[model samples]
Target: MTSASSAGPRRVVVVRHAETVDNAARIWQGHKDTELSERGRAQVQAAAPHLAAYAPSLIVSSDLRRAAATAEAIAGLTGLEVRLDPRLREVHVGEWQGLHADEVRERYPEVVAALDRGEDAPRGVTGETMAQVAHRAGTALREISDELEAGETAVVVAHGVSARVAVSDLVGLDQDVSDAVFRGLGNCHWIELVEAGKSYSEATRWRISGWNLGPWNV
Candidate 1:
């Protein structure tokens, strides 16, 4: 609600990549280079056309294959090239990368408890905090926002956590409280945000017009 003018608000459609095998097994995929599961491909097939209908001027994605695959699906329909950016990668969960949720809980109860208590704790003992993830992911999002021409939309395909955290950061939510506000984006689901005029602070410069949209929930 920050921008009053019609022309200044840029449309950014942030899509989470489809599910991966690791995701199906509830394993942490942080920085893991995993391809989309079969269902993920089906999800992309279902959602890509809807995203392409936005006629985005740019299609950017995390370098991870799952995100890249989703971006490519939309790109194929729009004739736009997918731009890979490592900065848009998922939060790195360190040694917890290959572990399932229960395994993590059993191995790192304190860390899990800290997070359960809403602390911005480091993941997997040596991994990055949500704030750290927000820094890099938010920077990438802002850059994408700046790259769009007036009234042009851009589609960014990213991992679930990265997409949520980046959007939360841009909209001025603290890492500690963001989780309470935003759940992980469903596979191939998307959030649509409109840029407020530059008059607002960075924390409030983005306004979410739609969130968690997809064939399943739209």
Candidate 2:
């Protein structure tokens, strides 16, 4: 999209939730709610201060507990109430939920093969596509951006996949391009984006100010 003037928030921070019990155990957690691990609580404590340094006015997050917990940490630090939204949740894996990664690889080798070949395969045969994920996640992000004033900032806490997909949408990059360019979103890590356009649309754009920042380097 074109880089015009910002009509909404000036800056935005996209954060991935910290480690969950499922995440630690390599379980496939798409739309399957799980609690944060002990390490995740500590991670939240560590990352919250860095996020608070931005002085963001709002904190939005997925309704899932994993993301909610992370958002709560920032809220505690910044005194901003957490806004829960289901749109920010992770991609639905259909039957893949509760299954381990290895199980998925074994049971859905065809779908996994397609995805591994860079094809946009539907997750778990009956789940949403990457495009669908981008659509819902992008819409949520746009709404959040629209709610802010020019000088305001907001933190969006979501899952790893949705976070990157939303960035690709806002930055006008192809999903495949972002899929290849962006690496892992480590637990409690975040990316900062500066709004460079008025409103969120095909003629608007955002600049990535920082990426993959965590407590140590934040």
Candidate 3:
């Protein structure tokens, strides 16, 4: 991620949704809308105190259940209302949505190739392209930035891919940088960003801000 100049204390905390059954099964989980596992619940609770410290002025979440549940906890802790935006949902993986990565390679080679190319196209099944998903997320982020410009500290609860891509755009990371960092979206992970003069800036510049330790149980 590249750095930019900023003038205010406007902060944007982007987080990945907590763990879910898909994660436990090693499935793709994109657009599958799975609920969080029991351990996932604990992870959310564990993040509460840390998030509360931020005392966010606004909280935005993906419309998906897993992300919503995670964001709900942050909202409860920070005493902020969480707003749901469907556009912030994870990229649809079509036929690969609920399949394990191996399964995708074994059963849907063509789709797998599409995924590798990072090209937005319809896979074996109906799914939105990477470009489509990225565009939606980028738009959502701009909305969040606009909110920040109006003087609000925001926390955005979203999926890993969407978050990664959005962060890539914000930091102007090239495909290689984005792909390397986006090997996978860390569950309940975070990246801190602040606004500068006319654009948003990243605090760490190129790294994600937080990590998840398996439901916070370990």
Candidate 4:
């Protein structure tokens, strides 16, 4: 349980990958390596300039195509290299992958309800638990932060659920209460985090200075 205050850069900007075909169709992607849709590309393009204004010291992204593409757009704008990390990938949904939202709702209402309540939803065979995803995401973020200098900002481009979980973990929101504390980020939307204190035992040592800042608004 490494805390955000224990070891890391002082700041981070986390962004959700642009939309994909699966996103528009309400289908589960779950590490399926889907590409960005045309609209997704445009969304990335729209966001690049706004993100570049941050002058991120590093740009990190999930290895999945959609996230990679989004990171690439920002990299091109900022002239920073994109570092791909598989650990930042979305939660593996296993049996739920490729299923429509309605299908999942009808087939796994209880699991869906659990997710809505920020509880550990049952991962079907071969899938990952939310706790598993959060652990990996937190570890990856810590590693990236460790490589950064204090006050330097790193932009992390990842999937929606993974980004939310990472932010929740960084802010020390309990897993069972995370849903009440955070909301899903829209495509190309981002949140900003800043270091507030130095105690690993205190979750309040980190602060979310910004939430869900969309490119259109910028």
Candidate 3 or 1, higher lDDT: 1
Evaluate residue 25 in candidate 1 and report its C-alpha lDDT on the 0 to 100 scale: 89
> How well is each residue in 109-140 modelled by candidate 1, as lDDT tens digits?
99999988888888888998888889999999
Clashing pairs for predicted structure model 3, backbone only: 5-196, 5-197, 6-196, 6-197
Q: Mind giving the per-residue lDDT tens digits that candidate 3 earns over 1-218?
A: 22333433567778888889888888887777799998788778877667667768889999999999999998988778889999889888777777787887899887667767766566546877656777789789767866654334688899887887776666566645677555665787676666544335244332333433233432
- For model 4, residues 97-206, the per-residue Cα lDDT tens digits are 99998998899887778777766755645689989999999788777766666557899999887888888887777766766666778999998887665445454355
True-structure RMSD for candidate 4: 4.0
Q: What TM-score would every model get versus the actual structure?
A: 0.91, 0.91, 0.81, 0.87
Model 2 misplaced stretches (Cα beyond 4 Å): 1-9, 197-204
- Candidates sorted on lDDT, descending: 2, 1, 4, 3
Question: Of the candidates numbered 3 and 4, which has the greater TM-score value?
Answer: 4
Instruction: List the candidate 3 regions with Cα displacement exceeding 4 Å.
Output: 1-8, 117-125, 149-151, 181-183, 197-218
lDDT of 2: 0.87
Listed per model in order, the count of residue pairs whose N, CA or C atoms clash below 3 Å is: 0, 4, 4, 0
